[model samples]
Target: MSDGARVIVGVSGSLHSLTALHRAAEEARARQAVLVPVLAWTPVGGERNYRARPCPPLLRAWQELAEGRLEQALGQAFGGLPIGLPSQPMVLRGEAAAVLTGLADRPDDLLVVSSGEQGGLRTGLRRALRRSVARQCLKRARCGVLVVPPSTLHEDLRALHRGIDLRELAAA
Candidate 1:
């Protein structure tokens, strides 16, 4: 917690991401900043229709569905979190790392994301993209970036989890 105005947490539908979200929430509360949990929706490659366009209504409905699921996930993860913070989840249409890096461009914003948990099967492109995006964010973010790994954030969070006044935490 510092004199930050906002903290953006990248929340993928993974256990590690939720852990990161919880930590970000606590940091936001302590810093007197609003929490914006972002769930990115990037469409993987599909067969291109050479002579057709999808309906706008259909796309809107799909967006709505994704938002609804995000809401449900938030409720399930943070319902009893005991986190007293002003926070909301936003579902955006874009690649995950890029979206997060873009948001980190704000002057008083901090980027909090989980790392080292995407070890299932990283395609060559996926690996390259992730590394590129992460490096860019580290270099460009105006405020500090918190890269929380699944195994480390738990203890780090315990140190930062004082649900007290933000001003006090920042001043200290």
Candidate 2:
């Protein structure tokens, strides 16, 4: 919200999301910017269709669950850091791709997300039918976008935990 640049990373309780969080934090550190870890969710179709406003209690419960998950993700991703960085955890109520893509409005802001490499055939098929977050951001984002692909044999999770050039990761 301030004039300072922001490194916005979309996150979930997945290996790919954790990788994105770590990379996003590194970019924020390099740029001396703020890091924002965001988790977005929408109610299941049944809940959305059954109620006019949806149950207030249920919505609150969902928020609490999402917040807990985000907290866990941040801890897991940056637990071993030598120093703290300016970071904010956000739980947004909406679709993940839309919310993340919307955050790329500022010129200096950078957005980070992961390709669903861990996702198997079903997920791939769904993404093929409906664009994944990375694809949507590439098409719609206004600022820089870094999409960390599903790490392969050469560039795996352990390697990611150590460190990888954000630019190089983006380029891959």
Candidate 3:
């Protein structure tokens, strides 16, 4: 496939990322473009205070794991080989947001990613920090950016619980 005629989706083996991949694939098919699934990974201990950087072996291991996870996510998204549009898996070694943003700069390429983590305390903290990957892409992307949010059922459930609590508080 041509370099610019591609729909790139960032995957992390999570349900949200897989959903983004599925959406990206559909977009690619609609646009008559190729689908490129990218997973960015970095070693946990890299640039630690005690050590300047992680060893090569550790980096290699992490890269291998990321590649495996990307493969699994691809399988989950397309149920094995994708039909119609050409699909490629890319394992990048760097921060997810930066890597995705860099790819988004490519001309005529569409970058897709999950908007944010599903509801959780950790995710809430990340959102509070304004550190979401999708937010970064939205800010910096030169190409088309699609931030695929989680299903609305999760939001509906949250609203339902909040409404019940609000009613109880009002009664008090």
Candidate 4:
């Protein structure tokens, strides 16, 4: 841990998350804080299901996969961890919002997360159906919460994925 300040960012390897990660890196650099990028995961099934099955090998494999994802997300965001910036990457097993809020339990820490509101109706519906991580962090974080909105590129990518014509959106 850094002596003075810490910037905690939730990372899930999504484009929105990567945008938040980049913003968090910028915040860390400006504040001279340690950057803590966290990727949270759960078992294939819910915790109840996992408890019933209790397969150690599968649990280990899932943890390894989460580790890989954290590395990959960092690489994709900065080609690797940002040079000249102090970073501690973590792969924890829990719900994303809970793990992030739990780690950001400091007065001076800053919690960064995506708004998770990009894409079309399906995306909106999906987020509405669940408790959004960003919303949860905003509500529960002990530290300052920075909710990064989805970048234009992320929205464009989502539109492209849905086969929507960009020009039509532009004209509208």
Q: Which candidate has the top score in TM-score? A: 4
TM-score of 3: 0.80
Sum up the clashes in candidate 2. 0
Model 2 quality (TM-score): 0.79
Q: TM-scores, in order shown? A: 0.67, 0.79, 0.80, 0.92
Q: lDDT tens string, model 1, 1-172?
A: 3554888988765667777787888788877888988887754342143115556676677678778766765776786323677775688877677778777677788799776444435535577655644455576667688987675644444346645555664588
User: Which structure is stronger by TM-score: 3 or 4?
Assistant: 4
Tens digit per residue, CA lDDT, model 4, 48-165: 8999989999999999999999999999999998899999999999999999999999899999999976657888789778879998888899999999998988777778988999
Candidate 1 ranges beyond 4 A from true positions: 1-4, 44-52, 80-83, 118-136, 152-172
**Candidate 1 vs candidate 4, TM-score winner:** 4
Off by over 4 Å in 2: 1-3, 46-53, 80-82, 118-120, 153-172
Query: Model 2 misses residue 75 by how many Å?
Result: 1.6
- Predictions: Cα RMSD each: 10.6, 7.2, 5.1, 2.0
Candidate 4: regions farther than 4 A off: 164-172
Worst 10 residues of 2 by lDDT: 150-159
For 1-172, candidate 2 gives per-residue lDDT tens digits of 3468899999987888987888898898889888989998877664456376668788788889998888888778776331568887788888788888886688899999998665558777887777788888888899999998765642555457668765676688
Q: Order the candidates by TM-score, highest first.
A: 4, 3, 2, 1
Backbone clash total for model 1 is: 0
